[model samples]
Target chain A: MQTEEEFKDFILNGHLHYIPNVSIDCAIFGYHEQTLKLMLIRHRNMSSWSLPGGHIKRSETLVEAASRNVRMHTGLDNLFLQQFKTFGDPNRIQFNKFDKEKWFEITGLTSWEGNWLMDHTISVGFYAVTDFSETVLQTDISIAECAWFDIGSLPPLEFDHSEMVKEALHTMRLHLYHYPIGLNMLPEKFTLSEIHALYETLLGKKLDVSNFPKKLIALGLLNKLTEKRSIGAHRSPHLYSFDREKYTLALKEGLVLS
Target chain B: MQTEEEFKDFILNGHLHYIPNVSIDCAIFGYHEQTLKLMLIRHRNMSSWSLPGGHIKRSETLVEAASRNVRMHTGLDNLFLQQFKTFGDPNRIQFNKFDKEKWFEITGLTSWEGNWLMDHTISVGFYAVTDFSETVLQTDISIAECAWFDIGSLPPLEFDHSEMVKEALHTMRLHLYHYPIGLNMLPEKFTLSEIHALYETLLGKKLDVSNFPKKLIALGLLNKLTEKRSIGAHRSPHLYSFDREKYTLALKEGLVLS
Candidate 1:
């Protein structure tokens, strides 16, 4: 929503268009220059940061809703998205923290007891990996600010979002062994050291040099180009690029990389 | 629900106690004696079979709701449950197939257009693995029958359940590589051939003999016992058992078993 009236109407009548008590929260992981970061947003009415999320529309699929939320925040489309988990603890949201009087002024409602937005909500968690350098973070009227935080040093998030981020990172790291990634995070032709660094950064650990790349090559997800990059005297390394066909197939049908 | 009045109340006022527009569906896979099967339920008012599922109570978490549903149908508890995926296609449910007149008679409502149970629902799919031989199938007032069907010869399921089963199996097989399983499906101290058969049955394919077990042993998940099982004359096999601590730890902190 972009206006006060729109936001008010959403609070009052959004159930007609959107599914009530269900939302989609995304953990957008950004990778650039071997640095891992996460996208977090602060609502205009909230004090703490949260994963960018919105209710799923009646006409949209879950992934479509997640993709829309991700695109709205990052200004990037078609990133690799995966649903990591769903959170549905009854006490997940602290309703006592809600500013009832503040919301009543905007919504013009005396009591918000039966409001559609006040019910127990279960959020579907989706994680996406993208290159942070290419993203132009945008904020709507509801969002006060949008920024990237280092994954290792995230602020205390609101509600159950901290657990969501932990689970998202765990699932993403596990997926690194089964799915082909780094297509959008790396250059068209990159050296083994570059890809190894990407894995090390994402996995948050040091891997044996060339061991991960060898598994990718054996899986036919990577192609070792004959051309070599010139860095220094007798220091050129062979360039490698992802086999798009095999990479796409591996994404659909998973494979074990280790 | 076991009574007609309870069912009617659930149809009309379930949202008071259950979250609306969100449901939980479970694909309960049963493994026993080198055979794999799936649990399917048939509603009393429906003609086809579907995965055993129910609405999440307002007080319960997602996994708790899933566990309740699985227990209601299988007479078992504390199975290995995993949330495979959340399915939310707009057209996933065929509303036109609804027996509106029959429901109206049961609900004593003139028009059922805005009923809590008739709205667009997004289902969270969870899958659990258990030994079929131990479960006693059950059916409530709404469910006409519940039975275990062989995995290879499943009947055409209703709604998006066929797709749900496919995704559930795909995810369960992928999980076998990352998480240790077969705890409930195997004997306490069994031979390598017994565990090998369990893996093959669950994966629906052949695995390299001694290769998979070797990985498990190296990971400290399996322990070799001095005791051996003797079958025929001079033919004996070493007994092995899972290290419960390591297996539980591996289940929480996933490891690459391949």
Candidate 2:
């Protein structure tokens, strides 16, 4: 670990004694196995599971800080990122007298020993959903390992992360029915069933195949590609991709997720 | 305006107490004259115009605080209230210097002053739209009169109210484009032209008459009221109100203004 002296004269000086004490955490979700899963890391210092998050930097906007943190920890830059909620409640943070020794080691070198870091923290939350098969991530050193936990079965998280995950999943599922996700997460050309599967995974329910395509087609937010997937031998479903210009404009005016 | 003795023990004991410091402000809007209008109150102590807003009470929830503030100021209640945005720029409060002398007269009591009073003021914003014809309101004593200003021809507002109005209008415009606002704003039954006119005004544009009904029908968030309008002789138009249940459900799921 770097000495406190090495970090003191840097930007930490700008923060100096004035760290706002707030952090941003993202419930980065990836879809696979017909289930929604969240990205989490095993903290090397603490030997506990935690959501991928970091403190807000002095020079960054909150949204920018959130986006940058997601990219920095997970190596998933240019991914779907959106601030969903902000959690603020007193008495949320607690470290008993016994836990302080280990807690300080986990937080890294610190100046004061008898007190916790900062006064109170308010965390801004962001959520993103993507198909896991497409991503190649670079895990940061603080993260012992990065893995996805199924929405139904999350491990015990260090803070209010489990609640954050649940809220994010619920938010994502709620959006899946009304809004199309192909604009950011889906590949250029994907099959009808693949999109349907993604939707089913998000909604956690089966969908009627007949009217779904007709409804999507009528919106004119999708463009059918002439090509079809070669891997699936039973039937070649028409490939489709989001119409960027129209999708963006639809998003701007008011698009119901239904 | 209570005395210092009434201060809570926790509040008085701390040098840097973290009060939520949030206030609720409503951008109450009404429709009239084939144009969108906003209900604004003249600043109590100054010639400046501002949205009717107030500090939230300690015992109330945010929504309750907003609703109460609207009713207290405009004397209009039982309306659809929506929180469109939360402004927390760390610099928003420092924008306008408090009119101390004027406030002293308006409240007729002095307890808080200096840093404590300044720190006591952070705000959350809400906006509502209603048809002005159906409601009666009595203005609060602080304002000379409540006036509806055309969205375009608004006077300069005090303390970031202009931006608040802009945000609220944007939210309302998004709602008019997507969700059905029948029972919520319009009467139980209304002509297609009335609905169309409302949308046209909020959207700040014109709509193709023939095509508008089809789009509304396609959304299925609205109901066709069978009642016919007997007032004007312009080809008896149908009367309808908003479908509250579907609209509420749609909104909860991810209804966004594009």
Best by lDDT: 1
Each candidate: what lDDT?
Answer: 0.92, 0.62
When candidate 1 is compared with the true two-chain complex, its DockQ is 0.89
lDDT of 1 by residue, A22-55 (tens): 9999999999999999999998888889999999
Candidate 1 pairs with clashing backbones:
none
Tens digits of per-residue lDDT for model 2 on B1-258? 133333333233323443234456799887764766788877445667888876544344556777887777556776767665555444555425545555544445474443334552335678877776654655654455667777788998877778788878776655554445545456556677776776677678777773455565565655787777677667676665556676677665544332
**Cα misplacement distance, residue B153 of candidate 1 (Å):** 1.4
What is the DockQ for all candidates, taken in turn?
Answer: 0.89, 0.13
Off by over 4 Å in 1: none
Q: Per-prediction TM-score, chain A only?
A: 0.97, 0.81
> How far in Å is the alpha carbon of A189 misplaced in model 1?
1.2
- lDDT, candidate 1, at A184: 80
